[model samples]
Target: MPVKYQQETAQITWEAAQALIEAVLKEGAAQKIAFSIAVMDAGGHLRAFGRADEAAFLTAEIACDKAWTACFFGQPTHIWNSLVQESHMAPLASHPRLMAVGGGYPIFYQGRLIGGLGVSGGTYEQDQEAAVKALSFTGFDKL
Candidate 1:
């Protein structure tokens, strides 16, 4: 069934998204670990998605949430790590639609914020590596 939306949206270009995903997977070759990747627009809306053949289903959703959190907050997920880990902040740690882990990164283009990328189903460092590769693929490595 076709879904309905109250507002219209402009999605990220598929070619750009694909380029980023492929670069990320290539970067993971040395580790031989599969991953699920998600990208979101500057507004925190999902723009693209990809998963390795054997990646877990949940990884995709988590990846999206992670990217969304980073784009929406305009910062890396790890930046919120300390705040969310505090006892008082624990109550909000499991917020319904966001992630506070270290694997998502915002994408910037031409000196402006463009979108973000998220990678999961691998070690945090590996996931971060993948995200970085994706950003590099988009020519936003300086970010």
Candidate 2:
């Protein structure tokens, strides 16, 4: 292999990220809940974020962490719970941005990892539902 080879990368567009945020908010409204939603690029950088007027302010950071966990790990944030159970893996929990909650999911398109979506301000199950609903509504792959 060449010392410095090129590689292709796919990313979530700003338009798509905005649409995902809107869809999550819409889902929250339909469920009579407030939510903070965040979208992160494949590299775990914040791309878009939004919140319902009544959502808890603290949920902003939680939402971003959730998305960061999912995107960077290439798995749902909740998976961290089981992954860290082993003694040898316990230290992984110390990573500040690793959210072991159910609201974050990786975003994929045609088998390509594009980004991640996260929702907060409700029960973990509810947050997960919102994230999944938005991904489905906006034509993103569901995890």
Candidate 3:
């Protein structure tokens, strides 16, 4: 006899990604800041992206890399900044896609890691605030 088995994984749906991006954009506008935002699925693949009209061209790539970095490490990029500052871990800063900044955050749903979100354009603190605000809108903050 043979048996069939399946595995379940959490993922960020396109609708959810769009909503997250919209929330981030609204937060940026409310704060009088413009930013480029990127969303990545659990596999680190780009799911959705948006850039404000006045945002810098470079911010698009930066935001994508930040999202990938957060998903890759399963942790926020800002946390990596502190970790990499230690002499022994300083080399991590040299990685091409590893941005040790505050704009990137891992997304969680129902206690499961689902995706990542990144925002770039304003100050690091502003970027972080926008990302957090978006995540909160998704109700991830309640988890």
TM-score of 1: 0.82
Go through the candidates in order and give each one's C-alpha lDDT.
Answer: 0.78, 0.91, 0.90
**Candidate 1 whole-model C-alpha lDDT, 0 to 1:** 0.78
Ranking by TM-score: 2, 3, 1
Ranking of models by lDDT: 2, 3, 1
Stretches of candidate 2 off by over 4 Å are: 1-4
Best by lDDT: 2
Error of 2 at 116 (Å): 1.0
lDDT of 1 by residue, 13-130 (tens): 6677778888877776657878888888878878888898878888888889888887877777767778887899888677886688888887766666677788898877788877
Name the Cα RMSD for model 2. Answer: 1.3
In candidate 3, list every pair of residues with a backbone clash.
Answer: none
* Candidate 1 segments exceeding 4 Å error: 1-12, 86-91
**C-alpha TM-scores of all predictions:** 0.82, 0.95, 0.91
The reply for model 3, stretches above 4 Å from the true place, is 1-6, 141-143
lDDT of 3 by residue, 15-109 (tens): 99999899988998998888999999999999999999989999999999989998888888888878998999999889999988889998898
Clashes of each: 0, 0, 0
Q: In candidate 1, which residue pairs clash? A: none
